[model samples]
Target: MSGGVDSAVAAARAVEAGHEVVGVHLALSRMPGTLRTGSRGCCTIEDSMDARRAAAKLGIPFYVWDFSERFRADVVDDFVAEYAAGRTPNPCMRCNERIKFAALLDKALALGFDAVVTGHYAEVRQGPDGVELHRAAAWAKDQSYVLGVLTAEQLAHSWFPLGATPSKAEVRAEAEARGLSVAAKPDSHDICFIPDGDTRGWLASRVGAEEGAILDRSGERIGTHPGAAAFTVGQRKGLNIGYPSPDGRPRFVLEVRPKTNEVVVGPKEALAISELAGARFSWAGAAPADAASGFDCEVQVRAHADPVPATARLEDGELVIRVEEPIEGVAPGQTAVVYVGTRVVGQCTIDRTVSAVPASR
Candidate 1:
């Protein structure tokens, strides 16, 4: 449990279902602060106490597992490496994929647990073919995108007690009705590691500032930036370009060339992407027979992003996606989650993109 209302109520629901649930809170940071930052981010000492209290109220055994070492090595290091390589990564997805499902689940199974339960707002159902992952009933709070990295084996041993909830408000109310103290706690926002939420500042501290030239689409130097790692595709603000566009329109970041230490900016139209290729593909359940050929599916690039109509196929050990309508700001290292209707079919970490501009591809 994360010491939040969602997890508290989820534990309650699990208890009510007659399962002997033991609450285990992950200590993700070795040096967590004693005070809460009022931002509701995880790994606080207060959160650990709150989780203990919830477990006490539920009358279940509780323990804090120290996974800080593995988390830092996998999620934190991967985040830094992705940014240094000029790719935008979703660390939450990485956490779910590496820490929660892989490491934690393996530990739990070794301890004779049949499954690992969490408070995630996603569904796992047994279909005729096999297990399938689906979006939560609460569309706004659905977290199927982050859970897309789960393979078929992981999904078989996962449970989400709050997946069928109508809304987050209902979950909070359930927590209140159950006498849980965290009913009104705010939802966690921003990256947990960067408490101040200054990603650029945090990155600069680790990667250091490498002064570089900011170029336009035609490779003409327009300005200078502290580093290419600070910029991301589709970014508009903080360009600091001295002059206005020739067409008197605003410009956006089109690319970040880390090898060249170049930040490429251009009109928003230059950010349009029609195709994407990704590596490290994993299917949530059984791979579809037509996966080798092209199959129609909805592709989601970011968490909470709208799924776009697309054709997906596995070619030469890579997942290639061709969207019916061009998507903007697709960056490498972001996950490309594929779905057929509401069920999560597969996902892959994006490696590259094909822009609308033929020359750029």
Candidate 2:
């Protein structure tokens, strides 16, 4: 429990189902303590106290596990490096895959727990073959995309109590009815490490600023940005360039070259990506037998992006996908999640992308 309404209600539901539940809180070192000014991120010292209070109200044991070192090595460092390389990395997915499932799950099993549990908005159902991961009933809040990195084995030993629940408001109501302490705590936002929402600023503090040139499609220098690390693919609003097209067209970021420290801008059409190559794949269900051949399914390249019609076919040790509908702003190092309806079938890291271009005159 993160000392939030969803997790508090999740524990209550688990208890109602007659399962002995123990609350585990991951103490990520990057989290700033409450004494630190403006530290509102989850996993902070204050949040842990709230979680402990909730566990007490539920009459269960709660302890904070120190995974700070592992989290820094696995999640935080990887996030910084991926951004530096001009790829949009999903740190949540990495936390699920490496820290939560691998590290935390193993520790849970060793401690005699049958399975690790979370308040995530997703579901796991067992069939004759094995367990399967599915989207939560709350479509808008479904987090199956980030949890898609779970292995078949992990899925078999996991439980999500809020899988069938509705909005967090309902969760808070349930908690209030039960008199839980965390009924009114706000939800945590993205990138728990950077609480102020200044990703570029935080990166600059860690990696010294190096100015770079901004370029157009034909490699013509048009403007300048603070640093290539400060920008990302598909950004348009913060280019800081006064250059406007003769026809009053707007410019958008199309590329970031770490090699020469250049940010590229062009018309919005340059953002289209037709094909994607993903590595480090993990199948939520059984690996598709015909994956090497081909399989038709819906794929999502970003967390909130809708699933688009696509085909997942393995080739040359990567998942090469052709999205039927072109989705803009796809970037390397983001996750590509495949699903059949509500069930997550597989996922992979986006290694490359190809978009359609207009024919030369």
Highest lDDT scorer = 1
What clash count does candidate 2 reach? 0
Query: lDDT of all predictions, in order shown?
Result: 0.89, 0.84
Residue-wise C-alpha lDDT for candidate 1, range 1-361, written one tens digit per residue:
8787788888899899999899999888876452235545776777888889999999999999988889889998899999999999998999999999999999999999988888899999997789999999998999999999999999999999999999999998889899999999988767888767788998999877789999987899999999889888899998899899999899899889999999988888778899999878999999988999889999999887999999999999899999999999898889999999999999999999998875353
Q: In candidate 2, which residue pairs clash?
A: none
Q: What are the per-residue Cα lDDT tens digits for candidate 2 across 1-361?
A: 7767777888888888999889988888844531122225667777778889889998998888999999888998898898888888988899999999899999999989998878899999985557889999998999999999998899988889888987767888888999987777777766887766788998888655698899888888988889888887888888888858655788888788888899988878778888888777878978877889999999987878889999989899998889887889988888999997888989989888887654220
Model 2, which residues run further than 4 Å from truth? 30-40, 359-361
Each prediction's Cα RMSD?
1.6, 2.0
